[model samples]
Structures are given as structure tokens and as C-alpha cells.
Target: MSETTEEATLGLIADIPPGFIHAFVASLSVIVVSELGDKTFFIAAIMAMKHSRLTVFAGAISALGLMTVLSALFGYVATYIPKIYTTYIAALLFFIFGLKMICDGCTMSEDEGEEEFNEVQDTLKRTDEDADVESQTADPAEVQKRSKILNVVRRITFALFSRVFIQSFTMTFLAEWGDRSQLATVILAAAEDVVGVCLGGVLGHALCTGLAVLGGRIVAQKISVRTVTIIGGFVFLIFAMTTLIFE
Candidate 1:
């Protein structure tokens, strides 16, 4: 590539405002890390296991984009809302999400009970120890079969799209309230003559969301869904508390 072209590429990557990038990076990092072992990742994995990778990516990326637009819209409006009011609102949302998480935890506990029941059923169905050994290992063919159904659901479900978008917006925005990057964006907005901060916020959030989705996929490999949700909910609770304290 030409030197000029390289510089242009570099600039594009680094172009967003420092505040937006900073807030986005900080908030996004925390979320991505926390989500690494959380419910969203499990959902992604379940989708991945049931569908083509392309379908999962499409569903996930679409959700992220929709979320980005909503978050940016909220961020822009937040610019006009009094800082104190905005902080309070964000904190309230975070706390609510935390409470929701707690509720999900209870529900998941019930599901564990169901899982135990399935295990007992499996034990009864086995005719011999050898059959039990075979059953213990999941058949790859069966997984592939299950994936086909998941892919269909992912393709046809408008509700999934809506749920993913709403989840994305709620998670991202709440994590961002009174965030350092947001504060930085405000400062950068005052310092720069152009819409540098706005652009930066958008770019930063885009990167953050991408990582968040990717991180979710990674976490699904190692952790159970119940664990993921519990962690995610608690993290929101902590962030909410921080918002209350700092705002």
C-alpha cells in the first residue's frame, strides 16, 4: 500500500474522539470480560451449535448494530439531559438489571433441578454400563442435528432479534453511565472544533460491541449458563452501585 493510504487507514482506526474511545474502551472491556463467562455467551454458543456459523454471526452482528444505534441515540440525548439526571437513570437501570439477574438465578436453580431429573431418566434408560459410557459422550451427529433446528429458529425468530437488540442496548448503555469515557467525551467535545467526540463515541462503541459478542462466544466454551448470568447480573449491580456513589 502507498504511504498515504497507510496513513489514511491508521487515521480511520484512530479517528474517534478520545472521550468516546476512552469511555467505550473502559466500559466495553469490563463488560466483555464479565460476559466472558456469562449468559449471553451461552446463548451465542447454543445458537452456534444449532446453526451455521454464518447464521450465528449474522444474528449476533445484527443485534450488535441495532444496539449500537440505540446506544448512540441515547448517548446523544444524554448530552442534553442534565448530568445528574442521566446518571440517576443509568444507575436505576443497572440496578433493575441486577435484580432481573437475581431472579434469573432463581429460575436457573429450578432448571438445575430439571437437569438432575434428566440425569436420573438417563440412568434408567441405560441397559448396560457400556451403553451408559456411550451416552456419557455426546454424539457429534446429534449436536449437528440439533444445530439445524437452532439455525431455523435464528433465521425465523423476530423475537430473538428484538430480544438481542434490547439486551445489547440495555447492557451497553447501563455499563456506560457516568463512565470515564463518557466524561472524556464531554471534555473532548469542548476541546475539539469538529464532531470528534461524537465520531469517537460511535467508533469506540462499535469496537466494544464487537468484542462483547466475541467475548460471549469465548465464554460459552468454558462456563455454564447459570454461572454466566449470575456473574453478569452481579457486575451490573456493582456498576449500578458505583454510579449511585459517583453520580
Candidate 2:
């Protein structure tokens, strides 16, 4: 291992007796298994079809990283609180999200959903443009000159980066709230080294979301958004049941 890995491992080992390797491997395996066919994976894929791949991946991974940190912290703190309450909360959230997704999938027509999505994108674009305009100086000539320059920059930056990043971040973050993978992270943290669990959990999520983004690009052309949403909804429902039974 590299020096950084060595230090991380040593740090984790200091707190937990199983050592870093064990904790890392176990956390990675569990999370990988738990996240497969999860809703967040589908969300990443769907977003990739609609937005820049890199930006979507960045946002999704960023959200997962945040979730991992929260999970680790919660797991560490879980030592003091009763774990059953956490489990119940996760279960309830999973069920509610699953139902909401299912309803959205079943109610929204493809054309309607596409229109709504486009509307949101357009709104965001306009909002960015408005903000750029508002930032201009008082002189009309300077304002016109700067506006022209900024419009080009903003178009490139916003179309390719900010819009996708914000969408992916918001979608993934909300979808991941009370997700089973996060709950699994918490459970693993309670049993293993916190640093190792967090690292491995993040890695597992990265791999899953990355694959989804890639796969989305190919499959989005073939499948309808409504169909994907319905499938994702069912997956979430299954996740809820599984979490209730196992976790």
C-alpha cells in the first residue's frame, strides 16, 4: 500500500480491532451488493441520458460521498443511541419514497414528463442568464460588452456543467436520503473501522453510479423514461421490504 493508504489503515486499525483491510473489504462487498438495482443507480442513468456524463457523474459521486460521510458519522454516534430507531426511520423513508416514485412513474405520460423536464432545464438556463445579467455594471456600453462576453462563457459553463451538476446533486441527494445502502453503511460502520467503512462505501457507490451513467447513455435511446421510472420504483419497494426484513 502507499503511504496514504498505510496511514488510513493504521488510523482505522487504531480504533477497530479487525484492521483496515477487513473493514474495507467487508464494507465494499456489502455496499456493492446492496446498491445493485437500487433507485439511485437508475437515477444516475436517467440523468446521464439527459445531461453531460461527467457532470452527472461528478454530482452523483459527490452526493454519495456526502451520504457516506453522514452515514459514518451517524454510525459512530449510533453507539450512544438505540439503533432500532434509525432502522425504523430508514424503513419508513424507503417506503414513502418508493410509493412516490411509483406514483410519478404511473401518472406521468412520456410526453408530459419530457415537457416538464425541459421546462425545468429552460427555467434553470434563464435563471443563470438573469443572474449573469444582474451582475453587469451600470454603464450601458460596458454592460452590453460584458453581457456578450459573459453569455458565451455562461452558455458553455452552464449547459455543460452547472445545470447537470445541480440536477444530479439534487436528485441523487434526495434519492439517497434514508436509502438502504446508507443504512448498510451505518450498520457496517458500527461493526467495523469508521474510516475504512466510509472509504469502501464511497468506492462502492462510485462504481455503481459510474456504471449507471455509462449504461444510461446507451439504454436511454432504447427505453422510455416512464418505464425506467416504474422499474426503479419497484426496485425501491423491494429495497424497503428487504431492509425491513434484514436490517
Candidate 3:
């Protein structure tokens, strides 16, 4: 039994691919840094303000994980092209990303991402009110006469989780469809190990999403948006250079 177990463990370790660690680390570091102050990050934070943390967390992480996997798949497809060309493409993409982020950072409004959160907040508030109104019975006396404990239990178990999860998932998925971080994942997956990139991106998204849900708004407020963007911009540029250099 011991010998069989040892063989199984060795087989598992041997099945692991090369370059996974490097790609995982690279993808993780880049995504975590870039996702700070992102719109989707704010979306998570804003939704958490009014919704259940677990619901929001589940929705946000799921959406991001889906996007990351899709991006990595696209990147893997691009790998069919010449390796040299793929490297150049990834470097070029990162360079363009760096420039774009820098320019946006330079010209960003003081309230760069705040408006999105406020809009989401107001819209969700209205939506929640509408939902409540729609769900109301014509006779409140009948509703009150029903078992209040059972009603509370039903709301907690069924109504609230579904509503918040759907909203959080829809909002986050839509917000992140074409975001920089998603694009970056695509580029990295194209040039690196796709599985590594996908795993790393998911981990990074989870971390960032968790932070947003927990209380990232406080840290966001403490730092200047402009500073974070510029820093991220520079980080992208450095990555671009390193991609080319290392390739």
C-alpha cells in the first residue's frame, strides 16, 4: 500500500506541467496590482454595502473566474501562431495597455470610479424597492397574519440570496467584460502557460474580489486614484519590457 501510494504521488507530481509556477506568479502579481481601483472592484464593494457578503462574494468571484477561463482559452488559441509572433504580440499589447492606462490616469477625473458606484447604488436601491413593491400582497394584514418567522426564514434562505446573487453576478460580469485585467489575462495566457495563467488569474480575482467585499472602499478612499493608476501603468510598462527581455 505504501509503495502504491508513493507511486501515485510521484505520478501526480510528474503530470504537472512545466512553466506553471512562473506563469502563475506573473499572472497573479500583475492582476492583483492592476485590479485595484478598477470599476468592477468598486462594483463589488458597492454591492456589498447593501447586499449579503456571501452572495456578492460568490457572484463576483464566479463571474471573474468565468471571464478568466474564457480569456485563457482565447489566448491558448492564439498560441497556434508562431511563438515568436506571439511573444511580440503580447509585448505590444502590454505596451499599448501601459500607454492607455498612463493617459487615462493623467486625465482621470477626481471621481474616476466613484460615479459608477453611486450609479450602481442608486439603481440597486430603486430596484430593491421595486422588487419589494412587486412582491407585496394586495392585503398587508394577510401578510402580517402569516407566520412571521417562516416568512423571515423564506426571505433569508431563498429570496435574498437569489436576488443579490443575480444582481451581483450580472453587474460584475457586464462591468468586466472588456476590462483591462481581462485583456491582460488574455495576453498573458497567449504567451505563457494557459492553465497557469487561468489558475493565477482566478486566484488573483478571488483575492481582489474578497478585498472589495470585505472593505476595500476604505483603502480606495485612503489612496489617490491618480496615484494608483499611474503606478499600475508603470507596472504594466515594466512587465512589457520584461516580457520582451525574457522572451
* Per-model TM-score versus the true fold: 0.42, 0.52, 0.76
Distance from true position, residue 75, model 2, in Å?
0.5
- Compose the digit string of candidate 3's lDDT tens values, residues 45-156: 9888877888899989989999999999989999899888988989898889888888988998777656545666677679779978966844776667665757878777
The order of the candidates by lDDT, greatest first, is: 3, 2, 1
Q: What overall lDDT, based on C-alpha atoms, would model 3 receive against the true structure?
A: 0.82
> lDDT of each model, Cα atoms only?
0.49, 0.70, 0.82
Q: Which stretches of candidate 2 lie over 4 Å from their true place?
A: 1-17, 80-161, 217-247
Cα misplacement distance, residue 164 of candidate 1 (Å): 18
TM-score of model number 1? 0.42
- How does model 1 fare in lDDT? 0.49
Error of 2 at 223 (Å): 15
Candidates 1 and 2: which is better by TM-score?
2
How far in Å is the alpha carbon of 88 misplaced in model 1? 1.4
Give per-model CA RMSD: 12.8, 8.8, 6.6
Ranking of all candidate structures by their TM-score, best first? 3, 2, 1
Clashes per candidate, residues 3 or more apart or on different chains: 7, 0, 0
Instruction: Give the per-residue Cα lDDT of candidate 3 at 10.
Output: 92
Error of 1 at 240 (Å): 1.3
Instruction: State the lDDT of candidate 2 residue by residue for 1-247, as single tens digits.
Output: 8999999998986876544665576567656655544567667776777678888999999999999999888878865656566556645655675677678779967654345445544655686688788776467888789889899988887876687797788878887898767876776565446798888888988887887789844443344556655665665566556555544
